[model samples]
Target: MKIAGRTFVVSGGASGLGQACVEEICRNGGNAAVFDLNEEKGAAVIAKLPSGAGKFFVCDVVETDSIAAAVKQTMEWVQETGKPLGGVIPAAGVGNPTTILDRNGDAFSMDTFDFVVNINLRGTIDLVRQCLVHLAKTEPVGADQERGVVIMVASVAAFDGQKGQISYAASKGAVASMTLPMTRDLARYGIRCVTIAPGIFESGMTAVMPEKLFKGLAAVMEFPRRAGQPQEFAQLVRQVIENGMLNGTVIRLDGGLRMPSKI
Candidate 1:
């Protein structure tokens, strides 16, 4: 609902859409803490904002220990200010393409496949569980406002999982699949769960693609014919928070373009 005075934890807040969301939150007078591996960028982001209980913590979200530590630090801060840790954004994720035809297809280097699933799926679940624990300590708002809100970032690959996207698809698809069940499980406590499934956007993935390739991809966006902006996605996040009724939804932020199987 009202962004001001709320406290939020944004994972992967060092850059990209997570960074934009953090900025938007601070701009709206809400306090925030970033949990990410990029300590340099995370610290810089915190410094640039108008400081008011906002800070950063280094975390390899794939590890339960790290997630628990993050929640510990965040709860400590919230307790200092007597504000509830209102919600979380598990926007930390990685993507790579590997064809099923490759000899390594089934042999997905435990290094890569495990890393992806651990960070994308397990990290998300870890945060949700921790949030529930902390939310239980807070009081729910009488009306539409929730005790907490969880917004996860899933890729369009989860939907159009291309031929070479075995691991990536499975990982993100898990996020897509869990949105509703999570909402239902958390409803009695006044907690809301939502997912953001972005299409080809100007994320780190597109940043590495060649200009020609990027342009070719952009030309195919279902409506805008261009990659959506981080701010656009953040705006939708704000909308989700305000429209309390919009829960258990995995919004496709890709301007109508279904991924052609990211491989």
Candidate 2:
């Protein structure tokens, strides 16, 4: 799928990996509807891009109304402009520390557990459904009639979620697990689906970690000895959009760092 002049919807594009993806796509002459809850950061990201190449949509991925509205707005924008809706990048996610066993050693708060799943897992599904509806409208003018491309961001924790990461890991793991079947299901629609498992990225839960802990984490990697840059993750997103053959596989963008049984 050629990216230039294409329109891609990037959820959580206000900062971190999503923001980088929006910038990267814009650089390739693609337009992006950057979906994020942070209006200020979303505007900031939009400001950094070429005028009219991108715009920000304020949205909370967990809400059905918000997701639907964002999708409607994006589709409307494309229809008015006569641009094909490229695809969706569901990057909005949340992580909160809550042990399966609380201080009293009882079951963890179901509320907390539900929060993670709702934002990370179900949110992706919501966007996937909305994206497919739009992607189906794209008619291939040439040999490449690719309707759309969907990229899901998961964590290496899905493979080895450490202690206290039960919720976070489980949510991320759900995203990873859905890749293969999602690809198969969406394939018939001319839509490609791929999952990216980033071991230790420079954002999300890891970004706020103390320097000492971050360094200790770097030491655990098999090579590269560092957390992945958001740009690196964005680069892979670009590859998924450009390389039509890559589909239905979860690529571990981690620097060979397998997380330990903590965090």
Top-scoring candidate (lDDT):
2
The lDDT per prediction is: 0.82, 0.86
Put down candidate 2 lDDT per residue, 16-113, tens digits, no spaces. 88888999999998999999889998998899898888988888989989989988988888877677888889998877757799778798888999
Poorly placed runs, candidate 1 (over 4 Å): 103-107, 210-213, 261-263
lDDT of 1 by residue, 132-165 (tens): 7887667777575468788899988888876657
Off by over 4 Å in 2: 141-144
* Candidate 2 global lDDT: 0.86
TM-score of each: 0.93, 0.95
- Top candidate, metric TM-score: 2
Residue 187: error of model 1 in Å?
0.8
**lDDT for 86 (candidate 1):** 73
What does the lDDT come to for candidate 1?
0.82
Error of 2 at 162 (Å): 1.1
